[model samples]
Target: MSDGVATVHLVRSPARTVWTAIALSGAFLLAGCGSQADLAKVNHPRTVVPAKVVQKPQPNTPPRPVEPVFAPERLRAVDPCALMDTQTLSAFGVPASSRAVALSDCGNYMKDGAGKRLSITLRLGQNVLISDTAKTTKLAGLTTVESTSTTTCFVKSVVQEGSVVLGIVAQVDYEGDSCDVGRRLNESAINRIRTNAPLRPQGNKGSLTSVDPCAIFSPVTATEVLGGTPSMTPYDLYRCNWRRDSLSFGIEFAENTDPKNSSANKKAEVVTIEGVTAYQRKDDSFGNSCKIEWLHKATTDGKGEVATVSVDNTKKGVDIDLCAKATTVAKALVPKLPKP
Candidate 1:
């Protein structure tokens, strides 16, 4: 038989080549365990996984309102004057010897226009009097005076008027005194000579009106209460009067230099009277000077209770004295006013 069919075909071809080499060694051990499980997931060890949460967007915002410290006519011209002299010594009437009574004005020889002519003399000693004119009061323009001396009675009055150019003489020295102490020192020197009167002409039709009762108490204006710079031509200072027990005020008259230019312009004339308002100021820093200021307020029966007085002109040289710095500028304007 041809070698028995070639030994069966070489034993089935060596069992089919050992079953194809065990199926190619189980497919190369399943492809090397699938590449070592992808190389253990590419060399493992990573784990961390917690990041994913975002939310942002916010911005916008707006809200703010609120609004008196003095001016009611300066609290109605406050001039309490120690409560008006303790209510005018408990209602009307004073001067029981008038023990130490004082009320003054003249603020050191007025000055504002430079007309310079001031002489205020009042002596009660050797009895020398002069001043009553219009031919000694025949009554034409009225310059009355009476008292031809009984024991020591002399009376004189000469007023040049406006800004005041006064000369008053009053004497009563009956050697034994007492006509109520010569009428309480002639009613305290005629109430300090009517607080330096002068400034009438209102209805007299002479045409001099004037106003400035401290600007009716304080709020000033009228050229800051007429301080300076008006050589005339209607500059008009101030004047006032209500009347009853008599009241008159005036200002505007300052000028008198050459004491070497008033001592090289250290000039002085500063008056600041509060209450009834009186402030006349002029300064040269204190060299050659002449100043005056007077301030007064009164009440006896006008309503009863109120009195204040102030006068100045530094040492009475240029001629206005009754100072205490006008009661220290009227107690510093009664605490800057504004309180009844």
Candidate 2:
């Protein structure tokens, strides 16, 4: 949405002179047959061709649709750190640190004069659930949902509302009334996104943000694994859920420690998936489920860009090997992911 406007502004500024110069240059020409000779004038009438006029579309003439400010495809390229930088946060407190918490999130930490901690988190494609107590207001020409707890405040503005709903969220945690701080941060974040927000590096060949989680697993693959046709639902751009009667499958791409070395796993069973070393674990504590995880690549600071697949048959009465089912889905998924 913002890119289209930038392009139009660029063309309008310098393109007018180019077209006008072409038209005027063709209308007249100087010719001299000899030194100190008088200029020759054609007796015949000369026609001057005017530059083509570019007209802006009128309101009543099938108005051009305004694209959503933040759509899924566009959000994938947004850099979270650029949305809320040190300069943008300097007003609240001394900007202490800023780091990327996730692909779509950046967390900023600061300290007030009294040495109290203050934080603001900016996220793209944030999933926000509006409760009855939450109030709605307009921020940057978009409907914003505001809610607060004792120490934290949440402000969310929907960027795209439809089957796959998405929003931009600004959360603040402060010692004082966080709502006031949240309001200012939210407004600044929105304005930056609409105007001069930075973007991810172009042509990131193997970035998972460009992949669609829903397209990774097909309906036929779900049916073959679950023994019944499954309904596919995407939680966000990075996660998808497929459910049958008593069986379910899920896949997600997110940040984590190396699955083989993660302490959360009771025992990491070494396994190989599509030539990639992986780990599988069975967890009966929560339900009859098994998970298979592998490191897609190292992102930053010992964090692994990982893909995890889970199979749950807790609802089924019979003793079905959940690990085998998880392996099947993992095999189908690993081959499709782009190599880092």
Candidate 3:
């Protein structure tokens, strides 16, 4: 799905995993911890390379004449976590999670409980105009191209005046109906876009969309969770990591990233706190770490506010309670998010 340009699949723990390419190229985003994109052979070389989102959204702006009403470049400046909303992905089981976004692409590494993983990537592009003469059936007025593998299904649908392409992928980690899973996501995204709404509602000061992810966590909170003074890992605005050796932990905030893509296909459950919703994404991808993503606060742009509290015990030596601990930190976070 967006692994830099493709979503990389990790068969190892978050710390030792390598981000081997799966699909798309806006490169996607880094998986696990600190690793770059590495080339891996894939069956489909025809997959589209994702582009970047907008540089920023200037509120009350006029639509560009030459570009599509909703410019994919506009996504570059926006939050990748906001691309797909939770409502669109609920069919996948887990309703909330995190993601890495780019100007024209977004994606997540989704693992089912059985040790199978499906990496889904979304890409935005423009293509030639189409007529009813096309072979594919018209769904929500967009032209679509769909393909399927033994365990994966891909659908590339046209949105925004029938020229903007929305490329979506659903891969099963251990062999399920990835095609059906993907089709659901693909259809939901198209329906939402048709609403033609702005990304975020205007003048909501409680919104965490622009807050520095590092600032969201305090040292006191860090001590309460990871047992050490926390330091920034200097990755990106949406992600924050503690640099100390006591334990590797941090809060990763995503504007539009949907947890449904990152949540476990099975054994993933929905938990509500203070009337706010989030997903506890537990994956054996790395036996030593776990992620708890709060899929709370819906964005005006059709995505939602997601906060992922994660832990990596690869270096900590101590085997701690990942979910109980993550939920503990999440409790402190719900109060800080945007609310009605």
Q: What is the per-residue lDDT of model 2 for residues 211-265, given as tens digits with 9 covering 90 to 100?
A: 6677767678889898766766554456676777667778877766877678865
Model 2's lDDT to the true fold? 0.60
Question: Which residue ranges in model 1 land beyond 4 Å of their true spot?
Answer: 1-101, 105-146, 149-152, 157-160, 163-166, 175-216, 219-333, 336-340
Better of 2 and 3 by TM-score: 2
How many pairs of residues collide in each model?
Answer: 19, 0, 48
Q: Order of candidates by TM-score, top first?
A: 2, 3, 1
Backbone clashes (count) for model 2:
0
What is the clash tally of candidate 1? 19
Looking at candidate 2, the ten consecutive residues that score lowest on lDDT are: 19-28
The Cα local distance difference test for each model comes to 0.22, 0.60, 0.46
- The residue ranges of model 3 lying beyond 4 angstroms of the native Cα positions read 1-201, 204-206, 255-265, 299-303, 315-317
* Highest TM-score model number: 2
- What TM-score fits each model? 0.19, 0.75, 0.42
Name the lDDT value of residue 51 in candidate 1: 19
**Candidate 1 lDDT, 151-229, residue by residue in tens:** 4433333222222222223333333321222223223333322332212213422111122224433323222222332
Regarding lDDT, does 2 or 3 come out ahead? 2
